[model samples]
Target: MRDLPTFDKTEIIRIVRRGYGIRVQKIIPYRHIYRLETNLGTLFFKPFHSKEAKLQLIVKAQEHLKKQGFTRFIPFIPTLNGKPYYCYKKQLFYLTRWIDGHPSNYDNPFELRKAVHLFARFHKAAKGFAPPIEIPDFLGKWPLMFKKRTLELKKCRKNAQKYPRPTPFENLFFKHIDYYIEQAEKAIELLDKTDYVLLSKAGKRELPFCHHDPAHHNILITSTNKAFLIDFDYLIRDLHLHDLASLIIRNGKASTWNLKRCEFLIKAYQEIKPITPEEFAVIHAFMTYPYDIWLLARARYIEKKPWPLTYYIKELIRKTKNEKARQYFLDKFLYSYLLL
Candidate 1:
């Protein structure tokens, strides 16, 4: 690992000891993580920086899950005053018992299946969790957001057309703009056909919490075949379909949009928590949105990051190549679930 920021050992030790009332014997650093060996047990200390209110809601959500007999999530070690986090020198920190596992390897089918299964369980356990703190709900705005992104892509296409001398990135974007626009339009059209508003309202009644970022990196698998979900930074009260879509999108992109792998993941998740037809429709709509392409457009046009334009153009080409396979997979899977 490259050089990481040096942390004050004495200060960390004091904080850990004060938080858990344990004696820290040693502190070992590993790639932005500090392992603390203490008389009580091995603990991992990581920097936590977020709005205090948001942090409180996360802690409450985890605690709620634990009470529901879901121990896969890493629980926050309370400070001396029973606070879930500690603030020192304008930095926030939290500790949790060290998990003896490695990041889930998506290449290993067994590991991938276990991760998907555990993710479904996590979503089930996360249901009915009412946060003590109030957080804004944006679940109802999904359609609006999808339409907005579609409009933005149209605007980008127009701007690309008007450029006096289009750069390579603009040229590549224009090349695929038609296909991308078609996808955005399809997403909006399908979204309009579905009762997404009603679904969102009904979903609010149950109030399922989603680990908005359920990528493979967040899943940990042990040698004994046990899986645990680690980070909850993006936890929010949204439909569980959001989490399912995220897993499929992340894994599908990595696997070049493999249809069988996508189906396997969906089946694995369904074995634990079955998805209704309405939910499946929303998932299809979510998958149809060209989120990756939109991000590339934003970075190249709006943000104007200094990264090489060719890199993103190449990515777009790769997506274009995989587009057929992705569509085939979506159609087959959606047909199996929704039609049959």
Candidate 2:
């Protein structure tokens, strides 16, 4: 609905000439994605940008699976010119086989259980799949963001008197900066310089394929109970616990069954591939990391990155109020897993 760059109808026609019909649809980032409806079938046309490198990594990841004969995913193919993607009017475009299924955001407990079990199975299946892609370094990004926020908050405090009345989170925000930064630093230290989680301490075996972004919304459930995970954008190798923690933080609270549903999902995932005692120990700590991420997200708004300051403040207050959940997990699970 917002203003988008005009695309070439000729390019759309070219692809359609090859027996696919073209219809301009939504413009999405990462890929100027288009929904192409052809008489033959419907599929997605995605043009890569500066993001081609990440997509290339994903494509390379598919090679590992293809060699082993897994076909659950449709990998990106290189064009005849040896380019993994195509360019059109200064924009890039590639096509993917459209997967038919509904996105289950796990609003219901049953769906949440299904999604959790599916992720566990997917991780287990990718255990032997190997790729040559280097894991991205997240340590620097987090610290840079934290530092930027600290400075911004400091500056904001200096001008605090200019605003007639301080918002509700105004006081709590200052009080928690040091605490959040300390926790953020602790997490950054734990991240090793690697492409994936070293499942093997000797750095021998790579951790299972991580969906990178493991929100419940990315899951697609077929009528037959099969779940297809779409979106490989954030796929990286990291501690399997990272994915678990992401799922818990982003999707756990949204589940209809609340704590009961979350417990069921975790238990189901454990049954498919048992989590190690060592990994289990830090699960609580990992779960709490999202709160830190949330703080950073809020900071982005406060820094005037297009997010509304009022909404961000409201969310900050809500997350701060939710600290008890993190503390509960720490008291109950962190002690059992990490401090044991």
- Cα lDDT computed for each candidate against the true fold: 0.82, 0.58
Error of 2 at 298 (Å): 7.1
Model 2: clashing residue pairs? 46-94, 47-92, 47-93, 135-195, 196-237, 281-337, 281-338
Model 2 weakest lDDT span, ten residues long? 194-203
lDDT of 1: 0.82
Candidate 1, run of 10 with poorest lDDT: 1-10
- Among these predictions, the greatest lDDT belongs to 1
lDDT of 2: 0.58
TM-score of 1: 0.91
Model 2 alpha-carbon miss at residue 248, Å: 2.0
Model 1: per-residue Cα lDDT at residue 338: 76
